[model samples]
Target: MNINKIKNSKNNFKLIVITAYDALFAKLFEKESHMILVGDSLNMSFAGKPDTLSATLDQMIYHTNAVCTGAPSAFVICDMPFGSYINKDEALRNCIEVYSKTQAAAVKIEGGEDRADIIKHLTSNSIAVMGHIGLMPQYVRSEGGYLVRGKTAEDIEQLVKDAKAIEAAGAFSIVLEGVKTQAAREVTQAVNIPVIGIGAGNVTDGQVLVWSDMLGFFEDFKPKFVKRYLMGGEAVRKAVKQYAQEVQNGIFPSKEEEY
Candidate 1:
């Protein structure tokens, strides 16, 4: 799947993106999601870390490889983990490794205008880049904590500028996370590239969610934007409890045990 298809999907339909850290969930996402992201959120979702800042490039590459194998026909984007792309040369080198090792369609970096030069460098080297703005998880410690952005007029102005800069830098699409609805709408209209939202509301070009959050697998915490479709944690507990009971009661195997 070409990244251009995703770029062209704007305004036609709401592009669906879901994060997957392994082959099982990636295969499931392939059935419906337009794109599967090997997001740094996996640090929390898969590794039980406190936040995305702990994710490493090797972890991202390992998961991206799994996603690529599971969703061979789906467009896959891997997140450039924290500290992986702090400079142009470093960004290019790491992105190239990610692309070559995983065969993912693109690499997503969390930043706005500050990352334009890096984005330009990556694109110049034939690497596709996806931009992320608003409440960057990688910057959470510096920003103080998770918070919604674009509340004030000045903030909205900066957001629009950032979106344009990202587009100008050659990003095919941008993820607007934890942005106010009006600001998200403004950014979506401000740029020709697609804007995918997460807690940024429905006015953007598309929506994305961490697969574990959506499926109710991450029971420790839930964000306001996430709408759990299934109580997977509960379901798994129930199944496990039943199995344990069956085994203790000698109900396992039954007549089929003869086989």
Candidate 2:
């Protein structure tokens, strides 16, 4: 989907967003999801890392390229990994590199009011941006942990301001993550752009979840927000076990199976 379609979907439709790290799932999600994010969460899900901080720009670009290759008609977003956009010039340079190296339709940056200027610079330079606020993973260490936001009136007000600022800075949309349901609804109303939520409730314009979490491939821990749609790991285990049993019994190569 393009920016206009995404913006128009704000009050009309519930946008579906899913994070994909490779071409296989990207293709599977393309027809159904409005957008596919090549998220830095890949560090945690794919590399078994503690957090997303260590994901680099090159890594993001590599995954973005794969997603784009798999879903040529899809709107793909590449995450601007932590430390890649510390300043306006650096942000612009890095974002430009992303545009040049991959087919990502936009870049998702984690921050809000504090990063408005950098967002403005990148947008002014013709780089599309999707703003991320509320419990930003990139700030997990500095913030002490992944905490829910918009619990109080003051917190809700700050969140509204952040949404407005990001929108004002030309972000086509925003991802409001790990927030109180009511507070997330308020933030979504305060902004003109679409607000995609995660652990932020169904009141927002849309919702996003990591593919593995939703599909039940990630069994280490289930977040409160994730609703497992399929027991992928269990199915895989069962299928493999059956195959092993058949092989051990010498039942795989019958006369009809001979080439």
Candidate 3:
């Protein structure tokens, strides 16, 4: 679906968004996912990095291009990494670079009322932006780890305010992450545009998850929010072990496989 359709989907069918870093998985996920995000979470899931803070704009653009190449018809949003949107002018310039270099329909920026000016600048320049709020991965270090938000009345009020500000800044949608369930529901109701959740609960307009986490490719400790649908890592290991056994036993290069 396009941006307009996704925006209009508020209170309608729940949108399905998933992260994809390469062409193969992007194509596989295109049919099921309404939107594919070239998320900076790739730094951890694909690049084996400890956090998302070190992910670069160039890396994001590269993966976005690969995803677009694989799923040409699918709407793709590339993530603007940690330091890429520090200010208005720099944010616009980087966003323009993304637009120029890849087929990404939009770029996601993590922030709220504090980053409204930057979001406004990008949208003003005709760069589509998706807003991200609550438990920002980029703020992990500064905020002292991934803490769930919206526990208090003041926090919930501030979340509503943040959603409104981001909407006012012209973001088509927002990705709300790691918040208390009731708080997520309130924020979703407060916003007219679609609110996509990740670990924030199901009351929102949509949901997103890293492909690796959902598919069970990542064998690391699973988060409470993640529900693995396939034990991909274990299956791969099992198949590889069989293959190794076959090769060692001289049974792999059978008559049927000969050139």
- Highest TM-score model number: 3
lDDT of 1 by residue, 1-259 (tens): 4677788888888889999988888998897998899999999888999989888899999999998998899899999999999999999999989977987999999999999999999998998899999989999999999989999999999999998988999999999999999999999999988999999999999999998898898999899999999999999999999999999999986898767
Cα lDDT over the full model 2: 0.94
- What is the C-alpha local distance difference test score of each model? 0.92, 0.94, 0.95
Tell me the spans in candidate 2 whose CA falls farther than 4 Å from its real position. Answer: 253-258
lDDT of 2 by residue, 1-259 (tens): 7999999997899999999999999999999999999999999989899899999999999999999999999999999999999999999999999999998999999998999999999999999999999989999999999999988999999999999999999999999999999999899999989999999989999999999999988899999999999999899999999888988999866678998
lDDT preference between candidates 1 and 3, better one: 3
Better of 1 and 3 by TM-score: 3
- Candidate 2 residue 223 C-alpha distance from true site, Å: 0.7
How many clashes in candidate 2?
A: 0
lDDT-better candidate, 2 vs 3 = 3
Model 2 is weakest, by summed lDDT over 10 consecutive residues, at 250-259
Question: Model 2 compared with the native: what TM-score?
Answer: 0.97
Q: Which stretches of candidate 3 lie over 4 Å from their true place?
A: none
Error of 2 at 63 (Å): 0.8
Which of the numbered candidates is closest to the native, going by highest lDDT? Answer: 3
